[model samples]
Target: MYSPEFRREAVAALKTSTLAEVAANTGASPSSLRRWVGRSDLADRPRSGRPPIQDTADQVVEALVATAGARISGKDYSTRALAEATGLSQSIVSRSVRGLTVPLTDVGGGRELSLVAAGFPLLILGARTEDAGGEDGGGGPAVPPRRIQRRIAGIAAALRSAGVGRWAQRFDSEHRQVPTDNLLELIAAGGSDRFLVFDPLGEVPVEVVAESDSRVEVHRDFAEFLEALKDLLAGCQDIPGSLLDLLSARVRNGLEGVLWRDSVGVDASRSSMSSDSMEISSWLPKETRSITEHLAIALREEIIDSAYEPGDRINPRLLSRRMRVPRASVDAALRRMVDDKLLDGSRGGARIPLITTGDVLDLYAARMAIGEVVLRSLSLRPQRYLVPVQLALRQVEASAPTRSGIDVEDADLHYQQELARASGLRESARVFEAVTLRLRLFISVLQLDYSPASDRIVSDDRAMFAALSRGDAKTAIEVWRGKVDNAVRHMAGLLGRRRFDQELWTQLTRSLA
Candidate 1:
């Protein structure tokens, strides 16, 4: 795990390097540090249950001694002025600055923040100030569009044998554009020397938005940016390895929601409908605000979305960049999720899990045995999980992808999560999630067409819900058992049809050892 000081150092390094490079050098993931940078809102989310009691009075006094640049300090600015800059409420500001450790010896028209005698070391860098007279947010000089185009062309030339495409000539956004048929067109037309106009805020045509295609990717910078473009293009042709890493990074930006809609088999119109309009308020818990909790959820969603597949190693450094938090926070979240059983591996490193047929069978048996007991008890207390189960059902239906493997997997996982929550067995919930993750990983790695199976999952979930409606615990348990059995057999059949990767199998054996 990374220490707080190290995390601060990594965040400070963001000044000189791109998030990707910083991650590569520091062993800190890009996403973590990104969050630590002015994106504090991501980390300040409220948690469920009791709030932690604060020694606010003491904190207010100590606030005076803390360095002004690093933290909110009386020496930096007045309470009202600081409140305006930080955009915090007056009451919060007042509570934080109400007391003083030392008497105010001077009276002046203006308040100046005082630094502590032994000022804190500069670990984390504060927010950046933009360049004067620069169009982009960065402080450096902007490279001309022609220079970027030529650089991309050179990279494309080098990667031609690897199925790299030409420089796309159009963009949806000003900085980047993902053309719908950019990959297919490049392959068909052969590589061409062309440059797309740079538009950071270009409006995508209606058709492009409607189709959710990835035709192009544009960026303002060269080098690393061009490398990302090359890998993304290569991914379109089904090449593996680093392309997966590229996808993992882009996944943080809603790549699945944007690019893979059709191939994944989603109900486009239904997806377009806002969740707010859906009747989820009755079942879905109020969303948690904690960044760690939120990151946990986001990571799970990305995993199910197949941003990183089985056998794909997670780069804590790169992941930190994607999640925009510190490596320490990412490590904490990973440990928590692993405890929850939604992820595999330990703090040494984490990966999306892989599974064998025996693992599938064992998972089913456990679910059947444990679920039976839970369902039987729920019959005596039907009120407990009933609402949550219904809520899960609603999410599955509302978010249903027409034939998407990930969507189906998500639905199944959501149902299981709700059931575990209802069972009032936190450990059980975690185990169930672990099982679900394994199954999802298997499907993603194989890229199996589980469309029909997805439909069946929803149907079975509804049957269970119907049984729950009548307080028929026995029927619900039976339905759940049948679903589990079916999943095991289905997975076993798929596994039989495909040969296992011997290398991955060996690695798994060693890891287990």
Candidate 2:
């Protein structure tokens, strides 16, 4: 029906009617009746029925399926069996598993993951009180425990200041709250090389159709504990706590954006901003098994949350400004992004060649087949460039009387100079883009204020220029890369947000072909 009132009424009536009653009244198949109850796309006869469930709990169910994947092995668990294991409704299990795209089985209402066949690890985050939800009195389905909102709020704030990970909350059918936690883990051994966090609560999460070594799971308790900590996250309203919320959101957003920028290509930017809070260095996590692990989870969620949306650039300089951490640290984090295959770039080695003869032949053939347009554009450039170069030379002479080129004066010449400067400008832009990315990563690691990262980057640049002038591309790149890598290592050393710049970058660029 066109009117909301009509839809509401029809839905109300459909929900109350028995399955047989709907079939008798509609004279349609039971399948059609079921579809009609939920379908709103239909116009006049718009199939209406019970109100659609909020589906928020699907995240919790999906988390359960992931955790369960780690716990079970070999043969895939039946949907019924998975339902029995994670205490989720078969429908929720099915939906979330499908939604999250994590490896899972959907039998009737339950979902299962075939970790063994896929060679994927079963991930298990830390547990909380709710993952072990109370049994339903009717015994038909088990509900996740209610999350302690106030407590979670407190923890999220503490995490903000303490430089620990984030803890998010969700409610179940029984109004019980559950937590979703993400922790970073580094694996370079097998399968896909990825470093972006995939909290459904955040931005992006990869789906595990069959399974492979690319995924890792934390202790179920960690995820559960994060749920319990939700009250702490939810209740805060001031200072460190209030800022913590924003930081938590930013942390999630920034990381995910960096992770996916490449796939989305040069068309997107990601960012998150938190209000001023106390400096976090001294308060950094001190425990070996601290709640810090959840930071990765929070970041993952924010990344997933930001999927498809443009966000702040992950430039280390800006992030250093925004995060108040050292720019050097930010650079390091960007390197990690490179390592994880989430993002990629190059100063000198971009097209240097990264394949064996056979592979090179294949790569070249493929490029030749599809890159004709770009090739033509490049070939036609020199011809187009001569006039611009001559004009630019004249400008340089006008600007600095006796200079051959490099003029910043004389509009037209300056303009052509700027045009010719495009390559360098583009390079710098790309580098800064890469820098901003690393900055976010560094911020997560140092958990310091934002400015320091920028300051540190400027400091590192002093040596950077010197290194570049020496004609030592590798050394210059190394020195520049080293400072950033150090920041990443520092960030990873914190607890769970391990460094992966080297690996990620290699993987991402390697596949540019």
Say which candidate scores most in TM-score: 1
- lDDT digits (tens) for residues 1-513 of candidate 2: 135554444456677888777566655566755665687664555358764453644544433333221112111334466567667677765554433321211111111111110001111211111112122112111111111121122223322332223223332222212222122222222234322121323312343311434344322233443443332222211111122232333332321211111111111122122221111111122353122222222232222222111122332332333344565655565565445433344441111112122332332233222222222222234433334434444433343432211111122212222232322344443333333333333333223322334334434444433433343334434443445344444444443333334454444335432
Per-candidate TM-scores read 0.42, 0.21
Residue 167 lDDT (model 2): 25
lDDT leader: 1
Candidate 1, poorest ten consecutive residues by summed lDDT: 116-125
Query: All models: lDDT?
Result: 0.45, 0.31
